[model samples]
Target chain A: MKKLYSTKYFKNKNNKHAEASLKKRLRFKKNKKKRNKIQNARTKPQKRVVNNKNKHFDYFKSKAPGNFSFLTHPIEVIEFISTLKSHFDKKRKVFILMNKIKSIDYSAIVILLSIMVKFKEKKVEFNGDFPSDDNINNILIASGFFQTLFKISFKTRERYNIGTHNAIHTHAWKDVDAELGANIMDNVSKMILGHKVIYKGLQRSLVELMQNSFNHATPTKEGEKHWWLSVNVNEKQKIASFSFIDYGVGIFESLNSKKEGSKFFNWKILMNLFSSENNADVLRKILNGDLHKTVTGKHYRGKGLPGIKEAMDRNLISNLHIITNNVFANVGLDKYELLPNNFEGTFVYFEINAQTSSTPWTELQ
Target chain B: MDRITVKIARDFSRTPGPRYIKEGKWSGEQFRTEKFYSIFDDAIKNDKIVVVDLDGTLGYGTSFLEEIFGGLIREHHLDYNQILNHLELISNEEPYLMTDIFAYLKDAHEESLVDNH
Candidate 1:
């Protein structure tokens, strides 16, 4: 009886000890979890807040020149964007500063829009601040830049009195959207002529450019490539400037890239020649239709670019400038020069004025 | 012989698209397969002339035009000369288009000959 009592008492004492140790371990686990929560909070990245005051971030600054324009300051603009793209490739968060910019144009705005859209698609974090100058800020807002960035509608433009500025707005499309093309032409005609007339030349030019992007912009499948277009109309001057941009394999590289399901081989010989030349000579030859037959081996193909050239020649459009790859050509001045820095895509700017011809709209039969 | 007229804008699309249907809606290939091919076949079979009115549409891409007119010869195996004989184009909006169509037809014919040889 004595032995049984003593054994039972000792067993109860051991159970009590184990219970106290379990409680102590539970307390340790709770403290560790709380500590981990604090650690994770400290390590996590902060969310970007896009507000009017524009909060500062630990971001690399992509500085713009005083004159932020492709037309006036081609080298500076291209080099800035080229470096910006390199920054994007590195997945670095960027803050594009236009505060120093005194003057800007729609051409540069459209190109920047394309780059920003690409950055968004790639999920590379970027923020842009408007110029400190009120006029430049208003121009940026009127050009539809802030609207696109902020996901605001035309109401923003109304608030800013966008009509005071010549920039009609900027737009983009991912595929060959013909209906949109027609609608744009209709609006252009309405803006320029004060009536809806079918501007066939401009419509065709726009469609051809869109089609080119759809087909040749990316090595990927169709509908994957994107094109941006912007229009600036000076009503009193009776002139409308159109800018089209596509960041793709470009005109020169497009010829060499293997097309989807195409039986023909890549243009090895032409690519070699294209590499050696100043690229201006190559662009001139391309505009003249000399390389099309040789590269494509199809007489039916390569008419689109030449067709645009023809429209320009016929005075349907004027002051045409083409920048593709490294070559920038003021086609009207018959001047083609190689840029010190390369632009990896195509930028086409043209204008239509009172001198431009149009096809009168007929009642649908 | 019946004069079969195909008004592109009224019958097919006011905004004709790029070459292939895979590219977008209302594509030239779609037009060729869905609209123009049967008319072309009927014209060939019945000794009728097919008059294509090219006005009223926004415009034509070179690819769109080539895919339809040149595609008749290249894709349908129709002789270019025979197709031209039966085809008449009316492009009041852009007369230059008619010239472009002619060039495409000749080029397609030449390509076909090269393939055969």
Candidate 2:
């Protein structure tokens, strides 16, 4: 349905209009929020947490071998939290045993922090001796996990500075401002993309991830929900890697867990479709914005997941990968695998090749 | 024959987007629906033909545009056709933006008809 008279056809008319309208259009909305935020900033506000110094609880009596490498074992970390729930429900004192932790990774950090946040919300007294491995301990502390959760100020740490390196890590054990993705872009862009700014598509995708982690991913225990984000750079390889983990119901699990989930499948069955459907197909469909039909009865939801494919389709990002529940898929690697055991929650990682994506990203703006 | 204009980057945060953050924020968060619509309403009340400059800003979110443009119909209770008659967007940089905005208006139109969105 192309119109006979196009805007381009009326360029002269449009310019004449533009010239006349230039001075009339008010720049009204731009500074309103900034002014309000500044006005509020003038008043000193109290800390967001209520820390209990007197009560202390031991988390685990046994040596905790929990680390990223250990977490990759077939066991579900959410179930581990379930084992601690009855004990947590019975006592106010909770202590975690990290002394036995010989190895750890990003996934391990997310799981530990998420579990701790859940317990913290229960008003249980909690503390733990640092893992004996100095490297592991330093990584955890630099990640802003403890400070962000407990409201402690560690001014001596390099975490306060932005230019220290190309790596970014933040664990939100509690609710937080939308700072992680923006901060990651600010810190890593100079070294990686030659700019100190974030791409709009990536920012939207990141914000959606954070929002979903908090909004729908109910914790195994009612009080705990957390998300961990990390972006590491390989300068020689000229690539950056991002890892985001949230322990909640995975996308298919979330959608299918509802009654609509079964109804959609039943419809598929009647239509002689969905014979080979698994989490991989479901994951792909979700990312392509094709799952709208299943959700139309509920509401126009599921717009966020497809943004990854949209960003990739628009060449905003590459090497997009995800593992949620029992499926593993990487768009760049051309892999969409369904593994043997369900991964429980979701784990996502992607690469930003500096050479191919060095331009200042502006598609989002 | 002349149109009214609103230069977003000149008056708002150059990278206008969402309004989730509330404190110690340096960037302006004027991307809210109420904020944008109030300005729109003033122009509408004056019976002025308006052109919104969607250029110069860092980028626009689907949610941001949907909330403001679709919300003109949804929250402000303005008719979509009525708003379209008076409102024109300047998205010369991304012609596809006009399409996106119209899709939101269409969704809002459907919702207004049956409250289905």
lDDT of 1 by residue, B79-100 (tens): 7878988999998877878887
Which regions of candidate 1 deviate over 4 angstroms? A1-54, A151-167, A258-276, A294-302
Model 1, docking class:
acceptable
Task: Tell me the deviation in Å of residue A261 in model 1.
Answer: 9.9
The C-alpha interface RMSD of every prediction is 2.0, 5.9
List per-prediction Cα lDDT, in the order shown. Answer: 0.77, 0.56
lDDT string, candidate 1, A34-125, tens digits = 97776566522212223322565577888987898887788888898888889988988788887778888778778777777666667776
Candidate 2, after superposition: displacement of residue B101 in Å? 1.9
In model 2 chain A, where is the ten-residue run with the lowest total lDDT? A45-54
lDDT of 2 by residue, B1-117 (tens): 356777666655554443233311212234434356766676677777878887754444445566667777777788777777778888765456687777778778887988644
| Backbone Cα, N, C clashes tallied per candidate | 0, 14
Candidate 2: deviation at residue B30, Å?
7.4
